[model samples]
Target: MFFGCEGVCLSFGGRRILDKVNCSAEPGRINGLVGPNGAGKTSLFEVMSGRYTPEQGSVVLDGEDLTRLPFHNRARAGLARTFQSPVVPSTLTVGEAFRAARKSHRPYLSKHDAEWAARLVHLEVSWETPAASLGTFDRRKLLLACLVMRRPRVLLMDEPASGLINAEIDELDLIMRRLVDEYAMAVILIEHRLELLAAVADDCVVLDLGRVIATGDPLTVFDDPAVREAYFETPDA
Candidate 1:
């Protein structure tokens, strides 16, 4: 496994949020993590990314144990994640933001490197444009470009397709494929959009009420009765 969490457990206010969950991603493949709202998908992401310390189990990347490392240290170890909202510095221009991302850690990157990363994601806005002025899709592309500039080995994306129009989603779909097929990075996606997963995911792990109820190809996993029930169940049931 290039990136994964094993036997992860988390709780809040004495209520279990995750229960011995195991999930992984492989290089050159897109692993889809899907479940209904409040199914613990985002919570598991927090544990894997070191934002929340699990009560048990560990987060591993390329055979190295990172259970105790902080989020910055995990980023240094080639693990990068995107949040549900695209956060770009409102005070900085596109060029300034990219420069900061380039110089964020050791082995500082160059302008050419930043340009290459921007081109990889088809970010065509003027470098002088204010980041806060970008539209939703452009903002997303900008953040993703920044992460790619660091050359991470694993990318965890949370609801990346959210708020995107159909046309924009098509563009994102292509970018994701390139990230896997061309860059060979292991990509794990947390998404509610099943069509996107069905089109791109190599495999999927479905969680329900803090437990994994199915694991297989997207088509097969989506077909599982347990998964269907979970998705369709009434909130107050």
Candidate 2:
């Protein structure tokens, strides 16, 4: 595993949100994290991304324990994450947003780096365009470009495909594949769209009420009786 959490446990207001949860992402692979609405998937992402501290467990990236590292520190250590919502700064122009991301930390990235990332994600907007004016799909592209510009080893994306149409999702699928197959970054994606996950994810981890229910290749994990019963079961069932 290039990046993973081991024995992670988390709670909020005395309610267990994650219990002994274990998940991992491999280099050059897409790992899908799936679960019911309250399955603690987002909370686990918080732990892995350092937004929340776990009572027990370790977050490891390339053999280094990052359990206690702050979010920015983890980002500096080759970890980056996108939110469930596309959060481009509304006040900034497309160029300004990219510039801010490039200059976010020391060893400032050059304009060429920003350009490369934008092109890689197929963001065709003009530099002068206001980030707030971008449509949902374009906003998603801009945010993804900002993160990839840093060349992080681990990328954690939360519901990136939300609000995207099928055609846009197809484009995103191509981009994700290139990121893994060409750039060799480890990607952990939290998504409800099983069709997209089935197409892109190399592995799947199913969580139910904060506990891992299954982990394996997507087909096998999705087919597991427990997983089907827990995740695929209809509300009326």
Candidate 3:
């Protein structure tokens, strides 16, 4: 397994969220996390990235325990994640962000490596364009490119399709597919858009009210009666 979470649980205040949510991500596979709003998908992503420690269970990466590692350590240990909201620095250019990530990790790498990474993510823009000037979709792509340059073994993405137009969503999907195919990275994508998720994910894990409701092929998960009911049925009085 590239990344594994077993028996993970988290709580805030008096309520429990993400109860024993077990998941495994393997290289070259995109695992989709799908659920109704407030189902704890983002919380699980946070836990995987070490933003929040789980109250119980373990996070293992490549057969080693990573439950207690800090965010940067986890990142250096071949883990990368994209935020639900893009956090690219406004002062830097898109190219600079990618270059900085490589420099931070492997300061001695030649300039060719940095250029290669930007090209890998389809970032052919001028190096001098300030990041603040990028459109929403380009900013998101830049963040992805920065993460990919690190060559992480696993990636955690939160709602990658949100705020993107249909055409841009399609473009982003193609980029993600290329990453998995070319880099063999394990990807965990948290998405509310079912159609896009179904198109990309090989398997889907459905969470409802912070628990695993179902796990299987995307078609099965989407067609499941429980999934539909949880997402659409009227609540019982």
Candidate 4:
């Protein structure tokens, strides 16, 4: 497995958030994590990327133990995650953000390598446009581009399709699928966009109140009445 979490558990204040969660992903596959609000999907990603250390659990990457590593160390170890709300530099252009991250992460990249990362994320900006001027969709796209520049073996994305228009969402979906196919990278997606999730993910893991409620193919899990009752039903019911 490229990435796996063993017996992971996390708590905030007096409340236990993730409860002995176990998840694994290998190359050439996308894993989807779906749940209602406060289900701990973002927390799990935090643990996996070494942002928030779990109270009890182990994070393994490509068979190496990564439990105690700091976030930057984890990034150097080939783990990268994109945020639900990405912050872009006000003075930098889209291409500049990619260049800066590449320089920071790899540092030894030649001009050609930098250009490759830019192309990978579909950023075609000139070196002059400030990143602050880009629209919300492009800002998110630039963030993804930065993640790609990190050259991570396993990539985690949180709600990447949220708030995007139909055309932009379709474009993002195509980029993700293409990345997986062409690079053989492993992806873990936490997205509320069920339609896009079903289209991209090979398997799905559903969480409820911080526990695994179901795990299976996307269609099977989505169709299950238990999931519908726990997550999809109107609260008025």
Model 4's alpha-carbon lDDT is 0.85
Give the per-residue lDDT of model 4 (tens digit) for 1-237: 569798899998989999999887777799999999999999999899888999898999988999999989988888778889867998887667656776785455555765776688777777577889877777887788777765678898899887798888888888898888988779999999998998999999999988999999999999889899888887673
Please report how far candidate 1 places residue 232 from its true position, in Å. 4.2
Best lDDT among the predictions, by candidate number: 2
C-alpha local distance difference test of each model: 0.93, 0.94, 0.86, 0.85
- Compose the digit string of candidate 2's lDDT tens values, residues 22-124: 9999889999999999999999999999999999999999999999999999999999899998978999999999999998998799999999999999999
Which residue segments of model 3 deviate by more than 4 Å? 232-237
Model 3: per-residue lDDT, tens digit, 1-237?
569799999999979998999988899999999889899999998899999999998999999999999988998899999989987888897667766766776444556776776777777678789988987887887888777766789989899888999988888888889889988999999998888888899998999999999999999888889998987567889
1 against 3, candidate with superior TM-score: 1
Q: TM-score for model 1?
A: 0.97
Flag clash pairs in model 4. Answer: none
Report the C-alpha lDDT of model 1 over 1-237, residue by residue, as the tens digit: 668999998999999999999999999999999999899999999998999999999999999999999999999999999999998999999999999998898889999989999999999999999999999999999999999998899999999999998898889999999999999999999998888999889999999989999999999999988988898456564
Clashes (backbone N, CA, C under 3 Å), per candidate, total 0, 0, 0, 0
Residue 6's lDDT within candidate 3 is 94
Better of 1 and 4 by lDDT: 1
Error of 3 at 148 (Å): 0.6
Backbone clashes in model 2, listed as residue pairs: none
Better of 1 and 4 by TM-score: 1
